[model samples]
Target: MTHASCEPARITEPDLIAIRDDLASREPIFHRPEWGSTRADFERMIAEGFWETGASGRRYSRAFVLDELERRYASPPLDDDWESCDFHCQRLAADIYLLTYSLRQGARETRRSTIWQRAGSDWKIVFHQGTIVQDA
Candidate 1:
């Protein structure tokens, strides 16, 4: 299916802007050092039952993902250069949003989706997944 089909709905204009603003900067999750890259920070931002399907199609549990992230960041490597675009936000329920975007890291391109729940002004990720975008 084309990337366009992935974006199924559009939120209201105002919420669209606010959600895009609130979420865009925090995405490609765990990559934004400005938002705190520590394990504790990661823990705080993730829901208790957080799970993810990696671009490789394997599901990862909350503890596994968190531990791996902590290990990877313990001695942070050179900053990764990635770009994300084709953003779309759909309101799933009150204060819950599904954000979809495409991410490029060097030669690898992937479609990403994150389910986030808003808690006042802060947000926590409930679920996330990524699928590799095949070359034409």
Candidate 2:
């Protein structure tokens, strides 16, 4: 049997735009991890208080966010397929974004946003927040 060599999928501008729109609109159905990871645990974390926004409008804890994403959201078999872009930056090359979505039991959409910073060759998350855009 001959084996076929696999190629990586390329990300494009439209893809980025779609991702931005999805997050901005809170369309949770399409939000999944880029690495094909699961988000069940992240969803749970959000359900809890790990990803909550306080009255001060600031996130409660970055440690909770990092831990949840790295350990749970980015795990195998689940596959988080979310996407994002640096729309606020003057140049796309200097801006970065991370986005995700979660739905309520009734299938309502909630979008998550995380601003990223480039460190060497990897993108590190500098900020994370999410909002419920619509019910349905």
Candidate 3:
């Protein structure tokens, strides 16, 4: 009988931090809803290899991110002002971290958290979870 070899797992906390930094760096670029403002930015993100999953459990690569951004831009405005954003590494182990970010814009604010693991030296994102919180 033939069997398939298992792929080794290589995830870490420092990796998660790097990914967070990379994503956070893009906030300013993504905040711009105009296609002209974001097209090249989104393309660059894809070239750099950022990826995420959708509610349907389908893997969304950097190309998908750009496509979705375009789709959103085609629709009515969906709030694009962020007064501030904060990130905290709640839990860390080797190359994994439970990260939380609180974002605020004018009178509205929300907090989002995610579990990130390193994929390699590049630090690919693994998971994300978010929630809204009342302003303190």
Predicted model with the maximum lDDT:
1
- Give me the displacement of residue 60 in model 2, in angstroms: 3.4
In model 2, the runs with Cα more than 4 Å from the true position are 1-58, 69-106
Each prediction's TM-score versus the true structure: 0.88, 0.37, 0.44
State the lDDT of candidate 2 residue by residue for 29-73, as single tens digits.
Answer: 224444224444344323232344522366666455546556654
Error of 3 at 89 (Å): 1.1
Q: Could you give candidate 3's per-residue lDDT for residues 10-66 as a string of tens digits?
A: 233563565566555534335644324455645643334456543344666666677
lDDT of 1: 0.87
Candidate 1 lDDT over 33-73, as tens digits, reads 88877889999899998999998889999999999989988
lDDT of 3: 0.53
Q: Clash pairs of candidate 3? A: 12-95, 12-96, 13-94, 13-95, 13-96
Candidate 2, residue 112: how far the Cα is off, in Å: 3.6
lDDT of 2 at 92: 39
